[model samples]
Target: MKTLLETLGFLALVQGAMGLLHEFTDWHVGLVQRVGLLDGHEVYASVALIVLAIALFAAAERCEAD
Candidate 1:
């Protein structure tokens, strides 16, 4: 459980950072854009990613505490 939470937290943080970078910068050459996952709505996708990252990190912290 702890490992799972930790992994999720890390993945969410990395993806969130990537999303933000792709949204504001000219770095639109990645798997996310390739598959049209966050194609048109980069802002929304970035926001969702940031929220997910925060939640995942919180969950990981809680799991570690327990």
Candidate 2:
């Protein structure tokens, strides 16, 4: 459970960073730009993802693996 949360947190961090990078530069990477639902709100979604990742990590730390 911890490992899963950590992995998810890492992925979210990477995606969020990549989204910001792509928006500010010509990187052309990350999944943010590929979502039709996001449209012009990728940055906000990326930030939200980062926040969710943090919460997930905290929850993981408080959980007891079976």
Give per-residue CA lDDT, model 2, range 1-66, as digits (tens). 788988898899889888888888968999998899999998898888889889888878887554
> Which portions of model 1 miss their true places by more than 4 Å?
none
Instruction: Please tell me which predicted candidate would have the highest lDDT against the true structure.
Output: 2
Please tell me which predicted candidate would have the highest TM-score against the true structure.
2
lDDT of 1 by residue, 1-66 (tens): 877877876776677677678767868643344447656876676667678878877887898888
Error of 1 at 23 (Å): 2.1
Q: What is the lDDT of candidate 1?
A: 0.70
Clash totals, every prediction: 0, 0
The models' CA-based lDDT, in order, is 0.70, 0.87
Q: Candidate 2 — which residues are off by over 4 angstroms?
A: 64-66
